[model samples]
Target: MSLWALAWTLVFVATAMGLSMWRRLGLEKDMLIAAVRATVQLMAIGYVLKFVFRVDHAALTSAMVLLMSAVAADNASRRGQRLAGRFWRVWMAVMSTEIVTLGFLLASRVIPFQPAYVIPISGMIIGNAMVASALFLNRLRGEAQARRDEMMVLLTLGATPRQASRHVVKAAVKASMIPTIDSTKTMGLVQLPGMMTGQIIAGADPIQAVRYQLLIVFALIASAAFTTMVLGALTYGRLFNEYLQPVV
Candidate 1:
C-alpha cells in the first residue's frame, strides 16, 4: 500500500475518537495517543526489520529475538510488580517458551533459521507468551487476595505453601490459558489471523498461508501453556513468608 492509502486508514482511528467523544467516555486522548504510538512503532519496526532481513546475520537475528523476548517479559512483569523477581520469572517463562517452540520448528526443518522467518515467528510466540504471563500474574494476584482466608486455613491445617496455594495457582493458570484455547477453537471460522491474512493479501497462495497459520496456531497454544505453567510454578512459592504464612 502507498503512503496515501495508509494515511486513509486513519479514518478508523478518527471514527473511534469520534465515538468516544459522542459517548462522553473521556477516552479520546487515550485513543488518539494509542493510534499515534501504534503508527510510529509500526513504522519504526518496519524499517528495523527491513535492515535485519537485509543483513540476515545469525548473531544479529538472535540478538533481535532476545531483545523482543526481553521487552515482552518486562511488560508482562509489571502485572506482578508486588512479587519478588517478577521480571526474571517472566523472562524465564517467555524465553523457555521461545526456545522450545522455535527449537522444535527449526529441528523439524519446518522453517529456515533466517531472520525473515525466525524473527516474525518469534515475535508472535513471545507476544502470546507475554500476554499469558501477564494474565496469569494478574489473576494470581487477585486469587491470592480473594482466597487469603482459604489459604490461611489450609496453612493452619499444616499444609505447605505450595499445597495451600494449589487451588489459586490452578485457577490462575487455567484463566490465563482460556483465551488462547478459545481463540484456537474458533480460529478460521471466527477470524483470519493477522499473519495469515497479511500473507494472503501479499499474494501468497491460500494453502500456503493456511499451513503457516496452522503452524502459528500450534506454537501459540504451546507458548501460552508453557509460559503460564512455568510462571505459576515460579510465582506461587513467593506467596508465603519464611514462617510459611501467606504474604501475597
Candidate 2:
C-alpha cells in the first residue's frame, strides 16, 4: 500500500483509543504508547531490512540474526529478573532454538541461505523462543514459590533439587508450550496466520503461501517446545540452595 493508505490505518488505532476512553478501561495511555512504539519500530526496521536485503552479505545477515536473538533473550529474561543467570539461560535457549531450526531449514534446502529467507524466519523463530522461555521462567518461578513447602518436605525426605521440583518443572514447561500447541491445532479454523495472509496479499499463490505457513507453524512448535524444555531444565535448580533445600 501507499503511504497514504498506511496513514489511513491510524483510524483503527484511534478507534481503539476511543473505545478505551469510552469504557474507562484505563488502557488509553498504554494503547497510545503501543501504537506509537509499533509504528516507530516497524518503520525503523523496515529501513534496516531494506538495507540488509540490499547488501545481502552472509556475515552481515548472521550479525543481524544474532542481534535479534540477543534482544529477544534480554526481553524474555525480564519476566524472571530474580532468577539467577536468567538472561544467559534465556539467551542459550533462544540461540539453540534458532540454530536448530535454521540448521534444519538450510540443510534440507527448504529455504535458501539468504537474508530474504533467513532473516524473516529467524525473527519468527526467535520471537517464539523468547515467549516460550519467558513463560517457562515466569511459571517456574511462580511454581517454585507456591510449592516451596511441598518441595521442602521432599527435600527432607532426601530428594534432590531436581526430584523435589520435578512436578513444578514439568508444569512450567507444559504451560509454556500450551499456547504454541493450541495455536497450531487451531490455525486455519481459528485464524489466518499473518505470514500466510501477507503472502497472499502480496499476490503469491495461495497454495505456496499455505506451504510456507505450514513450515512456520511446524517450526514454531519445535521452537517453543525446545526453548521451554531447555530453559526449564537449566533454571529449575536455581529454586533451591546449594544444600538442596528450597530457597526463598
Candidate 3:
C-alpha cells in the first residue's frame, strides 16, 4: 500500500476514539497514544530493518536479535513488579528461549543464517516469549496471593518451598501456555496467521506459505512453553524465604 492508503487507516483509530468518547470509557487518551506510538515505532523499525537487510552482516544480525530480546525482557519485566530481580529473571528467560530456538533452527538448516529470515523469525519468537513470561508472572503472583493459606498449610506440614509452590507454578505455566496452544490449533480453520497472509500477499505459493506459517506456529509454541516454564521455576523460589514462609 502507498502512503496515501496507509494514511486512510487512521479512520479506524478515529473510530476507536469516537467510541471511547461516546461510551465515556475514558480510554480516548490511551487510544490516541497507542495509535501514535504504533505508527512511530513501526516506521522506525522499518528503517532500521532496511539498513540491516542491506548490510546483511552476521554480527549486525546477532546484535539486532540481542537488542530485540533485551527490549522484550524489559517490557515483560514490568508485569513482575512485585517479583524480586524481575529484569534479570525475564532477561534470562527470553535470552535462553531465543538461543535454544534460533540455535536449533540454524543448526538444522531449517532457515538460512541471513538477516532477512533471522530478524523476523527471532522477533516473533522473542515477542511470544515476552508475552508468555508476562502471563506466567502475573498468574503466579495472583495465584500465590489467592492461595496463601494453602501454601502456608503445606509449609507447616513439612513441605519444602518447591513442593509447596509446585501446584501454583504448574497452574501458572499451563495458563500462560493455553493461548499459544489454542491459537496454533485454530490456525487455518479460524484465522490465517500474519506470516502466511504476508507471504501470500507477496505472491508466494499458498502451500509454501502454509509450510512457513507452520514452522512459525510450532516455534511459537515451543518458545512460549519454554519461557513460561523457565520463568515459573525461577520465580516460584522467590515467593518463599529461607524459613519456607510465603514472602509474596
Candidate 4:
C-alpha cells in the first residue's frame, strides 16, 4: 500500500468538520479552515520535499533544519504572545524547546541525517514542542492571571517568583505532559499506534515493529518532556515580577 492508502483521513476530516458545524461547537469553522489549510500546506510541502531530497548538499540540509525551527517558532509564538509578555520570550521558549529536543534526538541517533529521516522526525519533534509550548505557556499565563492575588501574597511573605508560581508551574507541567502521559498509558491498550501498525502493514516482523514502536514512543515522550520543562521554566520565570517575585 502507498502513503495515499490513508484516504480515510479526508473522510474523517469531513465528518469531523461537518459534525462540529451541525452541533454548533464553535470549532466548526476553525476545523474546516484548518483542514483546508493543512491540505494545501501538505501539498506544497510534498513538492518541496521532492525537490529538497534530490540535493545531497550540507547547506541544503542545514537550510531544512532552519526552516523547521522557524516554523516551529512561528506556531509557538502565535500561541504564546497573548500570555507570555514579549514576542522574544515566546521565541526563546520555542527555540529552547526545539534545541533541547533536536539536540538529544540527533545525538542519540533516534533520528538521523537523510532528508527522509530529517524531515519526518523534525516534523514530529517540532509539532510536539509546538503543542507543549502552546499549552504550557497559555495555561501558565491564565493561571497566573487568575491567581495573581495569591501569588502577590506569597511574594509579600518573602517567596520568590519561583516559589510563588509553584502551583501554576505544576499545573503547566501537568498540562504539557498530559499528551505524553496519555500516549504511554494507551499505547497498546486502547489503540495500536500508527508507527507499529504501519510497520506491520509494511510486512515487517511483528517483534521488530514492536521494538521500533517502543523506541519511537519513548523518544517522543523524552522530547516532549524536555520541551515542556524548558519552556515552562523559561516562561514561568518571566511571568513573575522584576524582583524575582511572582506578580499580582
Candidate 5:
C-alpha cells in the first residue's frame, strides 16, 4: 500500500512486456501502453475517489456515478460499430440498467445511499453492464452474419423482421449472460471475488464479507440480464432496413 510496494508491482508489467517481446508476439507496445494506462487511470481515480469520499454529497456522488456509466457506455459502444446509433443505444441500455438496479436497491434500503457504498457498487454494476453490452454486440453481429442466408429466406417467406431475427437476438442475449451466470455459480469455490477479498483483508468479518459478496453477485446477475435484454432489443431493430432486409 506504500509507494515502494506499488512501484514493485511494475515488475509484473515489465515481465509481461518482456515475454511478449521474447515470443515475437508483436504486442510489446500494446502491453506497455496498457500497463501505463492502468497505472495512470487507477491513480487518478484513487485521488478522485478520495475527494468524493471526503465530500460525501449526494449530488456529487450522483454525478460521479453518471459519469462512470457514460464512460462505460462509450467503451462498450465501440464493439457495436456496425449498428446505427450505437452510442446512444449502449448509453440508454447502461443508464436504464443502472437506474433500475441502483434505484431499487436504494429505495429498498438494501444498500446505503452514501458515496462510500454507492460509488463502489455503482462501479461494479456499470462495469459488468459494459462487458455484457460488448459481448451482446459481438455475438449478435457474428450470429447475424453467420445466419444471413437463413434470415433472408425467412424474410422472403414473409416473416417479420423481428420474427426472422428472433433466434439471433435470443442467442446473443443468452451468450452475453452466460459468463455472469457461470461466475456466480462458481463464486467462492472457484475464486475469492475482489470485493470480498478486499473486505476480509481490511479486517472485516468473513461472514459480513460473504453477505456483501452475495449482494453484489445478485446485483451483477440482474445487471447483466437487463443490459443484454435491453441492448439486444434496441440493437436488433437497427440491423434491418426499411425493406425488412438484413443490413448487418
Candidate 6:
C-alpha cells in the first residue's frame, strides 16, 4: 500500500478501536488520551530513529539502543508495581542483558554492526526483556507482597532475602518465561510470528525464513532467560533488606 493508504488505514483502525474500547469500558477520556499518546509517541520515535539511523557512528547507534532499552525497562517497571530500588535493579538487569547479548553478537559476528543488524536485533531482545521483566516483576512483587508474612517467617528463621523469597521468585520467573516458551513451541504450528511472516512477505524463501525463525527463537530464549533471571534476581535483592529481610 502507498504511504497515504497506510496512514489512513492506521488512523481509521486506531480510531475505531479507541471508540469501541471507550464505549465498552466507559473510559472515553482514558482511551482517547492513550490513543493520542500512542500516535504522538510513535511519530516522535519515528523521527528520532530517522535521525539516529542516519548517523553511521557506532557510539551514536549504541547510545540509541541504550536509550530504547532504558525506556522499555522503565515502562516495564512503571507498569508493574515495584519498589524504586527494585525497579532500578530490574532496569539494570535488562540493560546488562542487552549490552552483553548485543555486545557478544556484534563481537562474535553473529549480528554485524550495521544499522540493519544492530538496530533490529537490539529491538527484538529489548522488547523481549521488557515483556519478560514486566511479567516477572509484576507477578513476583505481587506474590511476594501477598506472601509477606511467609517471607518474614523465612527471614526470621535465618534465611537470606534470596533464600527467603526463593520459591516465590522461582515461580514468578517461570511464569514470565512461560509466554516465550509457549510462543516458541507453537511458532510454526499454531502461529507464524511477525518476524517469520515479515521475512516471507519480503520475498525471502520460506525454507530460509524458517531457518531465520529458528535463530530468532534461540536468540529470544537466550535473551529472555538471562534477562528474566537477572532482572528477577536484582529485583529480589532490592525487595529485601540487610538482615536477610524482605522489604515487601
Worst 10 residues of 3 by lDDT: 79-88
How far residue 234's Cα lies from its native spot in candidate 4, in Å, is 1.6
lDDT (Cα) of model 1? 0.95
Estimate, for each residue in 2-73, the C-alpha lDDT of model 5 and write its tens digit.
899989999998898889889999998998888889989999999999999999999999999989988998
**TM-score of each candidate structure, all chains considered together:** 0.93, 0.94, 0.92, 0.76, 0.91, 0.82
lDDT for each candidate structure: 0.95, 0.92, 0.92, 0.73, 0.93, 0.79
For model 5, the stretches where C-alpha displacement exceeds 4 angstroms are 14-32
Query: CA lDDT of 54 in candidate 4?
Result: 89
lDDT of 4 by residue, 1-248 (tens): 35586666678888987888888887977887898899789889888888888875657866877777677767776765645453455456656655666677688887676777676666676677677777777777778888888888888898877788888888877888798789789889999988788779889999998987776677678767777777666676777656665542
Q: After superposition, how far is residue 162 of candidate 6 from its true place, in Å?
A: 2.0
Instruction: Compose the digit string of candidate 6's lDDT tens values, residues 1-248.
Output: 46787677667656766787867966666656886799799789878778777876788888878787878877888745547665577678788888888788778777678776677778888899899988887788788878889888887788877788888888888989999999998888898978879889899999988886787788788888898889766777767756566666
**Looking at candidate 2, what is the lDDT of residue 80?**
77
C-alpha lDDT of residue 76 in model 4: 70
Provide the lowest-lDDT 10-residue window in model 1: 73-82
> Which residue pairs does candidate 1 place in steric collision?
none
Name the lDDT value of residue 162 in candidate 4: 79
Candidate with best lDDT: 1
**Could you arrange the candidates by lDDT from highest to lowest?**
1, 5, 3, 2, 6, 4
Instruction: Enumerate residue pairs that collide in model 5.
Output: none
Total clashing pairs for each candidate: 0, 0, 0, 0, 0, 0
Please identify which of the two predictions, 1 or 3, would achieve the higher lDDT against the true structure.
1
For model 1, how does the per-residue alpha-carbon lDDT over 74-93 read when each residue is reduced to its tens digit? Answer: 99999977899999999999
Per-residue lDDT over 30-113 for candidate 3, one digit per residue giving the tens place of the 0 to 100 score: 999999999999999999999999999999999999899999989999986888898889989998999999899999999999
Model 6 gets an lDDT of 0.79
What residue runs in model 2 are displaced by over 4 Å at the alpha carbon? 21-29
